[model samples]
Target: MEKGKVVVLEDRVPKLKERRRQKANRRLIAYLSFFFLFILCVLYFQSPLGAVGHVEVSGNRHLTAERIISLSGITKRTSFWKVNEQNVEEKLTRHPEIKEATVEKQLPNTIAIHVREWRRIAYVYDRQTFFPLLENGRLLKQEGTKTAPSDAPVLVGWKDGDAIAEMTGQLAELPAAVLGAMSEIHYKPTREYEDRVIVYMNDGYEVSATIRQFADKLSHYPAIVAALDRNVKGVIHLEVGSYFVPYSPPKKEDGDETTSP
Candidate 1:
């Protein structure tokens, strides 16, 4: 080998070692800085600066704020850095009535949790027991469960849990006047469609509709009723478009024609 080549080769080893040493030093400094920051965090969290002094909850209706906070295990004494948001969220979500929960930190000592609760739209009857079904498609306790809203529709013969989706959808599309006039809903599980709903109106009339077409048809009930003579009696047929036929009295009559409502 030439002398210059030999000298260059000899010089490269120390330079490589020095570079590795510098890299190692940088890594050590990073670790030390992280450790120091971690220590400071621990101290700060423990020193009342991170203690939860204020807790706020919003968007909760069915669930009480205190009950939700208790379930979350985040209290006034909870350390801000030590707060387990995921755990709190999971705990809040354990109740099927809760649709969603979001936890947010307000400041050094404040935590806010927003929760959306599932609203019960209808009640399902399994035999004689009536179980209230939430909008998210969960059945509440049947035996001695809390009373649902007085205006909520009572569902008869509907056990398929998926019916909740249709019920919610129909309710969403219905105008408030027609919706408030509804007294009962009978979910007839027909071979054609399980979502068929037979409604009993407060006006002593029955409505035939599938959940698919209920909202649209019900919304137009006012116009349909307006066209009909109120003196005539019959259930308003809405399964298709608006049609009103006179109610036939329970007797065998040959030529008797009833007036249309």
Candidate 2:
């Protein structure tokens, strides 16, 4: 019985040693894996691989790509992990010409910026220069040019601030074709018609209209002009009702119908 007990104790010693060996192997593998991951993370952040390599800009017109990128405050040296998309977008939108802006990050090394710029619809003459007016009724002094814009109508005599605002709003609602047909708009308010305006058309006809129903009535201008005799030059009254009054030719003096050459 003493010999058998000694044999059993001897067998248990090897089994315990094997178990210890297996545990140490697992620990070694765990340590190696952790170190490998740490090294990779350090390399990724410290190397040029994590730097912004490319910047793409889209949907920009009045503002150039370089200008948009400059406004965004992002550079090629910026780290991919450190880019703040919301902050960049806010900075880009601060430009008066940019209506909307979006910034996005592409994995590994690229930044993309998209922007929408304001549309220049017309120009208002001020201090002998024409300043660009946006579709939203905002005027941009920087967009001013020394010469009048050929494609847009020139606003004249609408000096009152409120009247100018109202006129701009009305102009915004008119179709591009209708607006293009007009050469100039002059404010000619009367006691009976306080909102009256005189519009000189590119087609050589004059229009009398009130601001209250300016856009609504001017939409019918093409039809009204088409119904009239094209050879006759006249004033189209769109205030009380739409009608045409032909300009009277010069009359002969002292019953003489013949003219001197």
Candidate 3:
């Protein structure tokens, strides 16, 4: 009706048809993709392919694989996709011996659980029965059949609970070599220091140290022993300062220890 204006259905027909065809093709492609995805999900979930078939436990010493796996609550019936990693790990760390735990899912329907148990820093005696003192300062009663007798320090005359706890804490900080060298630790509270302790070394030597800064001072034990004359073994006093006091040859008092000179 207006000047220089024209409406022709034939001219626009091909363009409109082409656009509609392209849109239909996109819709068909989307439907096919969704259909194939649904099929895959159904096959995976409906059959035993997606279920956990095996469990692997590692990094455990005091605890067995079966025990750790049981604690993690992971069984063959547990769904691979439904297994919550965080939940299983938290469950494993609930035990007193377990210090850390991690959960990982492996390929081909397998779940892996990794754990780290606390170290046995020392031992204390209760009515002649030996108990392991953990790095966390907890006492655990177990058979001494597994112990080599020289594995850790034996705490004697440790009547005070707090003293034993502090001693365990100190022993845990020592290096493996230093801790292994110690055989016995007797609680001998002196007038000046209540935390005074007498340590008997495996190398036929004695050490006088207080509970405070015990680990720091004891770290130089290997060097101190190395510098001292091995032929002349006496007492390595670490309470006030690092010095070697040779045992006096004159034995006159009844208070002398059988082991000390």
What are the lDDT scores of the predictions, listed in order?
Answer: 0.76, 0.85, 0.87
- Indicate the worst ten consecutive residues by lDDT in candidate 1: 142-151
34: Cα error in model 3, Å = 5.9
Full candidate order by lDDT, most accurate first: 3, 2, 1
Best-fitting candidate, scored by TM-score: 3
- Against the hidden reference, what TM-scores do the models get? 0.59, 0.69, 0.71
**Total backbone clashes of model 2?**
0
Q: Residue-wise lDDT of candidate 3 within 144-167, one digit each (tens)? A: 434435678888899998888888
lDDT of 2: 0.85
Q: 1-261 in candidate 2: lDDT tens per residue? A: 686566667878999999999999999999999999999989988888888899999998666898888888888777888999999989988888889988888876899888888766567787888887777778888877897676778777667878877878888888888888988888899999999999999999999999887889998889998998777788999999888888776455696878579
* Candidate 2 stretches greater than 4 Å from native: 1-34, 150-152, 176-183, 190-192, 200-206, 221-236, 244-261
